[model samples]
Target: MVDDRDLLKVVSGIIGEERTSDDCCMIKVGDDNIILSTDMLHESTDFPRGMTDWQIGWMSAAVTLSDVASCGAVPLALLLAAGLDEPERISGITAGAKDCCERFGAELAGGDIDFHSELTIVTTGIGRVEDEYYKTRRGAKPGDIVCVTGTPGCAGAALEGSERYWKNLVEPLPAVREGRLLAVAGVSSMMDVSDGIALSLYDLSGSSCVGFEISMDNLPLSPGVSPEMALYSGGDFGLLFTCGRDILPVTGVDCTVIGVVTDSGEVLCDGVLVERRGYSHRWMEEI
Candidate 1:
């Protein structure tokens, strides 16, 4: 069966790989570069049964805004498209969306609505990035240290019906602040870990044409999370970056050095080849 990646590849063939592949599309606006990105959330697929409307809205907005942060851009505004048959929950969703944007120093500009059988939310974020602070997955070089903000495996634990991890899974807090900090510190390459780290590593490798050797002992795993879940589960929207020596101090967050870039064109986990896979829409259905 065709997956999201396969479909994206087809789209990339038409619009050019660079434009279609990146999380956000960049455009020159005078001396500054504007970043624009969009992400979608559906109730059946993205939201679990117990999630509140507030958490749903917050997560939807966070996912899109995270893309802007991944590009080292400061978010300015968001546009939301919420489709739902249950109009009563609209207020909760709106309130949550507004709150998240405000906390991140951004605005919930405006959006459209439609009626649907199930709830659906689509968010688009617009942000600005200074030329010098802009970063992408393409700049990783050999000898650069692979780093990550925050921890992983919480989402995976939540997926396995672990109540202890519900907050981290449902109310995901993206590393926007940390991302901007890394950008200013001159990180060579970066991306958010929406997919599993293994898949993300493969993506970084593909983009930069480099390899990675990850030390399993270095992974910052959440409590009760196995290495497989930490490596393969999704919904941990932390920033993964590659940078030179002399790591910059990211105030208010613990950044961990998990690995290093190599010329081997493979992703190794504790000196073993890790399978290249990650959670996608199709993968989510199986779960």
Candidate 2:
């Protein structure tokens, strides 16, 4: 018999070790602080077979950083859990991870490795945020404006076609400084567009019993990306936040008010219902 539940159990155990995603999961213990986020880049599942070792390594770090970034936590360090085919490949993976992490001002604190048939990189990041203006998904008001930074659906769109999606793999994540900027602006709430905007909105609206109203026409899609997919694509890695009804003044980062928070759980695209949510653990059978 196979133990399919083993991984789920272990993951639950690890997250349960502390607390998982609830009560906002934090501890004030001493000077060292912690914010836990995990991202797994499975070769077969996440990337196309022909992906370069460098892209694989870089993306492995970027995705995890997205979680930390959305939390408005200043990324301080990262640790890797890898399974490599050869000892030599470890150098490439480490170098790739180092280049990406350093680009974002985080350090390769430490990591562990084991041998495997295929390469697997799991990144765990730890960061700390000041008590003041620490962003959360919990504070959006009914009339708050829904704003997003940079373009939407770039990462996901880049993965779709020959010319565009591949090019974005190397495009540095627009995180770090921008997230801090939004927080200081006294934004009501924030989250990164890791999963499509739709799923992310629901995740952020958790327990608050608040829903979101999004204007699809206002969605900022990258030139190479399509609007049809932008509405529900994942991996964009842009910041989606809520503020007052009007767009806030910002520099360096492009901001747009694409929606408004509401008391109902239904999400609308210019007053119409949207289908085909975000990503799935299985093949993307579009809804």
Candidate 3:
């Protein structure tokens, strides 16, 4: 079976490594750098059961904005394309997308609507950042501290029948403010933990050419969430970052230093190799 990351290698082959390396593609525009990203969500896959149309809309917008945030960019606008199963869903979806954008300092620009068998949404986000402020997943160095914002696994817990965490899964918050703060604080590398902390660490390791030594005891798990869920569950839109110890105690952000970078180029948890497992889309080869 081939996964999304394996398919990304094909994309990288065609687009060149520089273009395919980051969460958001960077384009130089005048004195600033513009970062652009897009995401697609479907009713059958991305959205969980019991999520309202409003939450569906919000989640669609959030996923893209989260990419923008990962680059430490200030979101400026978003374009939402809705393939609706029912026309009535548009109203709730639009309202939710607009509210999320407004709350995150972005605008919900006009978009396209089309009829479809299942509700689907495609969102494109545009953001701006100074050349010096933008962060990427390729700068971590040995000895840098690995940190993550907010408690992961809340969404995973919600999926496991925790009613208290339902909102966390349905309407996950993008760490836009925290990304900017981390960039200003000179974070070496940063990305969102939308794909679980374990997989995210591997992605960072691949890009930054460094390894991680994370302490399971230091992970900030949500109440009632197991260690496995916190490490491997998806849909947590928090920032995972690496920085120097001199920059300890980043202000105004709920982040925990869970590990440190190493030159070994392998991700380890409690002195053992961490498995490369997470929420990834997979396709089996026909035999």
Candidate 4:
């Protein structure tokens, strides 16, 4: 079976590696750089059961904005394209998207609507950041400290029937403010931990050419969340970053240093090999 990352190789080949390497594409616009990102979600896959139309809409927008935040950009606008199974779903979806945008200091500029067999949404975000302030996934150095914002596996716990984390699953908030703060603090590299910490560490290792040594004891797991779940569960939209010790005590963001970067390209947790498995769409080979 081939996973989504394997398919990304095809996209990288077609669009050029430089373009597909980062969370968002950077384009210079006068004094600031415009960062753009897009995400797609479907009713059957992305949204969980019992989620309201409004929550679905918010999730669709939040995912893309999380991408923009990973780039250390200030979100300016969002464009949503909704494909609804029922026409009435459009109003609630639009309202939810708009409210999310407004909450994060962005506007829901425009979008497209259409009928489809199932509900689907595609959101595109536009953001701006000064060239010096924009961050990427390719700058970690050996000895840099590894950190993550917010407790991971909360959404996964919610999925496991923990009502305490329901909001974290349904209306996950992006780390836009924290990303900017980390960028200003001159962090080496940054990315969102939407695909679980283990996979995210591998992605960062590949990008930055460095490995990570994480301590299972240091991971800030949500209450009652197991270490295995914290490592592999997805939908936690927190930021994973690397930086030097000199930048400690980054104000205004609740982040925990869980590990350190290593020059050897091997990811380890508690001195054992961390598996490369997470929330990814996989396809089996045809017979």
TM-score of each: 0.96, 0.86, 0.98, 0.98
Candidate 1 lDDT by residue in tens digits, 175-272: 78888989998899999988988888888999899999998889998789987887888888998899997766666657889999999999999899
- Per model, how many backbone clashes are there? 0, 1, 0, 0
For candidate 1, the lDDT comes to: 0.88
How well is each residue in 1-287 modelled by candidate 2, as lDDT tens digits? 22322344465587772354321344676864466677777777676656667766777777777777776778888898889877787777788778878988899889999988877889988778777757777778888888888777776766676466664544437477788777776787887776778766766666345777887778887776777666677767788888885447856557888888888876667777666367546423322
Q: Compared with the true structure, what per-residue lDDT tens digits does model 3 show for residues 234-273? A: 9989999999999868788999999999999999999999
| lDDT minimum window of 10 residues, candidate 4 | 278-287
Off by over 4 Å in 1: 283-287
In model 3, how large is the Cα lDDT of residue 165? 95
Show pairs that collide, candidate 3: none
Best model per lDDT: 3
Q: Tell me how candidate 2 scores on lDDT.
A: 0.71
lDDT (Cα atoms) of all candidates against the true structure: 0.88, 0.71, 0.92, 0.91
Q: Write the per-residue lDDT of candidate 4 for residues 1-287, one digit (tens) a residue.
A: 88888888889999998887787999977777899999889998899999998998888889999999998899999999999899999888998899899888889999999999988899999999887778888999999999999999999888889899999999999998998999988899999989999999999999999999999999998778988878888999999999999997899989999999999999999899899988888889721
Worst 10 residues of 1 by lDDT: 278-287
